[model samples]
Target: MSVQDAFAAPRSAVRDVNGGTGAITDTVINALKKTRPWVLFLAILGFIGAALTLLVGIAVVISSMMMGNLEGMDAEIAPFGSGMMIGVGVLYAVMAVIYFLSALYLLRYAGAIKRLSSSLSVADLEAALEQQASFWKLIGILVLISIVLTVVMLLAGLGGALFMGAAGL
Candidate 1:
């Protein structure tokens, strides 16, 4: 069948590209149904992780403030006194937000898959896949950002080392 015909085909009428008799759509739906529970568990776990990350960020900020107030602290801890710990905490909070968003997408996908399995609504299936795609897209973007940041940090560190070497320090 042509691409248009394939797109127009009903779920019950859909077949494999090899012209098999079985409905490929049904197979995918069944697989999604089987995976729903696992996705739900992952979503719950991710949410818990995000909450813990946020708590850790808060703790770090508070501890940094306390450390700054302490007398006779080493000069090497100047960054914490200068609010660098707050920056680190904010970074952690941003990561937690990303994790929370990923978890939300997973939860939505699981719910949509469950609904589609019961009623076989094409809209519900589409929604489920859309959520799954969104989750992957978010992860892909974060990975790319992380790679770029790592490269930039590596270059900065190399530059610092070169400068320090030239200064005989």
Candidate 2:
């Protein structure tokens, strides 16, 4: 994708959707109605997944604390296990937060669709599309964050490996 497209708000949401007196047209409403069921289902699924993620994070942290005593091991090594587990749990918590927010946006989008279905007005249509746009914008930001984090972690791992090799560890 071009730099402009990459940086731009989700194309699907910002793109001009032609409409009548209201900003959005009938065709947009028709399409939204068609996707309403799927949108609702996805939002519900996201909520469930976010809850599970949070639970897993709590479990990890608790389990790590319980198992952190590397009994009989060197003091230097003992902290590593606990720290890694805690870090992973924290990451999971962060993921859950992002997941929950994304789901909320989706749920709101679905609500907008419902509103449009009932009112069939230009205002309702515009609001519904705005919700949809918000959802996509969040998802795009999350993807970019994930990519950066992955690259950073990879580089850290590589750097550690090189350091170890150089030190003859």
Candidate 3:
């Protein structure tokens, strides 16, 4: 059958396999609508976190420079601080990239939801869902990486801070 013919509705199956006018589609669309807002909120939060990390890194660098004792500081502690800062910066950059990619995926999903709402064929809906699943998988990987990086950065910062405090620097 031609592509158009495949998308054509099956008259005999108008009532669907079970009872009701395809309420499952409506349910899924509603869920997507509810989820879109949360996704947008998360993206915004990610951006904010990245911005805060950048600001904190800048503050640390400035404070270190102004201390005049930057060169006099313990070499071990200095390396730890520098490494922590660099790790945090890398984490923030990764988070920003993840946020942008996830946002794009969510926006595309939102568009698909709209098309489904407007009575897209089941084939079209299925295709959209397949594409969404791939995007979700990528998003999941990015989120996991971001979490791991953030934790590493946090631990490094804590260790550096403790060392600095103990050394009376």
Q: What is the per-residue lDDT of model 2 for residues 23-138, given as tens digits with 9 covering 90 to 100?
A: 55556767898899898898899899999999999999998887776478777866898889999999899989888998899899989999887777767777888998999998
Better of 2 and 3 by TM-score: 2
- List runs of model 1 lying over 4 Å from the truth: 1-25, 74-82
Residue-level lDDT of model 1, residues 1-169, one tens digit each, is 6555655746444534334432347677779989999999999999999999999988888887777777787777766464898888888899899889989999988999988787676667778899899889988999999999999999999999999999999
Model 3 whole-model lDDT (C-alpha atoms)? 0.64
Between prediction 2 and prediction 3, the one with superior lDDT is 2
TM-score of each: 0.80, 0.80, 0.49
Q: What value of lDDT does candidate 2 attain over all alpha carbons?
A: 0.84
Per-residue lDDT, model 2, residue 19, is 53
Rank list by lDDT? 2, 1, 3
Score candidate 1 by lDDT: 0.84
> lDDT of each prediction vs. the true structure?
0.84, 0.84, 0.64
Per-residue lDDT for 93 in model 1?
Answer: 93
Candidate 3 or 1, higher TM-score: 1
Q: How many collisions between residues are there in candidate 3?
A: 0
